[model samples]
Target: MMKNYHNSSLSLPRRYAITAVQAAAFFYFLHCSFLPFPAMQFPFPAMQCDLELSQNVIEAYIQIEEDKIEPMQTESPQYMSTWTWAYMQSFQEPSWHRALYKHLLEKLGKCSVLFFPIISKEEFHFTLLTFHKNERKWRHYNPLRSLGHRKEERCIDMARNFVNIVEGWLEYIRPQAQVFIETKKKPTLVKQKEGLPTLVQKDLTPTEELTLNWIMQNPLQFPFEDDMECAQQSVSSLDYGMFVMFYMDKIAQ
Candidate 1:
């Protein structure tokens, strides 16, 4: 029966067509098993798979580039304006004003007790603005009008007046501030002399010790030189004098 079926009279064209179909199906199976299917080869022809994939890649690249860029730095406009104003005033103002402004700047830079230990540059700038406002008041009031016409004479007179006022104020407050410091147990240690050992002690009250240290370290060096006529001036304005008095009260408290 098998020999008879093989010898059947099947057409040559029909047999060739069947063999070609079989070969094509075999190749298709091999391609699907061995190779990755590209987007174009996807069965769903209407879906935008290729476009979605390209968009994701582009978005990822953009995010990576954004991460590589550094953020911009910014400064406070108010602070910059105040600093500029102070810088200009220091150069353009009179000698007395320049001296006082320079003294304040040094104190602010050092974070002195005068500013209540101002910790930030911004706070120092704010204090400077306060000083400027007080200066304008002093100009309006003209406290030294009776002193003299000459700027030098006025500066010397002002310094003498300041020394008198501060001395009187210190005399009044010394006892009280001493009591407060002792009660609070906050005595400020100070070096007696440049070469003295730290173990060396001084027989001084807390108030006297603090006062001596402050004078020694004071940037203005009040009573500037031994000569009253030629000494560099500081805090000539009454407004600034009152300002110092207010902070001194705070310190004593």
Candidate 2:
């Protein structure tokens, strides 16, 4: 219907106006229903301001290693029910977390969400997962429960949100890198006229020193997950069928 309207014999200007209006409406809806990465506020404090920012990522990621060993498990009930469950089950855990997430993946019958590892500096993480209906399969698990659906609308939002959400997560986690190696690497490859360039040894950069100082004082900001990234792929029914995996590397100085 919207497409046919564009093909009508309206004046060139009228047709153009219609297209612009359609585009504007589309963008408005997209923002309203999806991509709700609002700036941290009263309801939700900013990731930066709520806690201390770390200058080192390596040692910080290590200090919180134990917490990552046991991630929350949601993959199981996610497949069997239609009721709306909790907010997230994103990855950041190591051993038990993987086992639980795997178990849940096999049984999901309804929707699946992509998540950013919510690494905690205070002994826990705040994973962010998106909910999606597994429409490709027949199931009684949709929480929406028989309302008319918007296939295209949801897909577009999911697509846009996927990238923005990862970036938003990055914004929240980047400061942790300050904990490991100095933020500014000392100039190593100096060019000397002789056979080899000499390496100038110096103390940690001020930023690096500052990060270490802060961590010793305030380790509550569980900075370990700073080494983590989100699942690289977007979600789909097959995704609902299997578990998503994101990789994390311990920072080596």
Give the alpha-carbon lDDT of every model: 0.28, 0.27
Q: Candidate 2's residue-wise lDDT over 1-253, tens digit each?
A: 1112243221123343344344334443232232212222223344333211211121133334424432333221131110011112233323222233222223222113322222222211122233222221111111111122453234333334433433343343345435334444422334479776565643444433433343334322211111112221122111111111111120100
For candidate 2, give the lDDT of residue 145. 10
Instruction: Judge candidate 2 at residue 23 and give its lDDT.
Output: 37
The best candidate by TM-score is: 1
lDDT of 1 by residue, 60-151 (tens): 32334335433321110111111232233235433222333323322322222221111111111111111111111111112122334564
Q: TM-scores, in order shown? A: 0.20, 0.19
Model 2 segments beyond 4 Å from truth? 1-86, 89-149, 180-253
Candidate with top lDDT is: 1
Candidate 1, superposed: residue stretches over 4 Å from native? 1-149, 185-209, 212-253
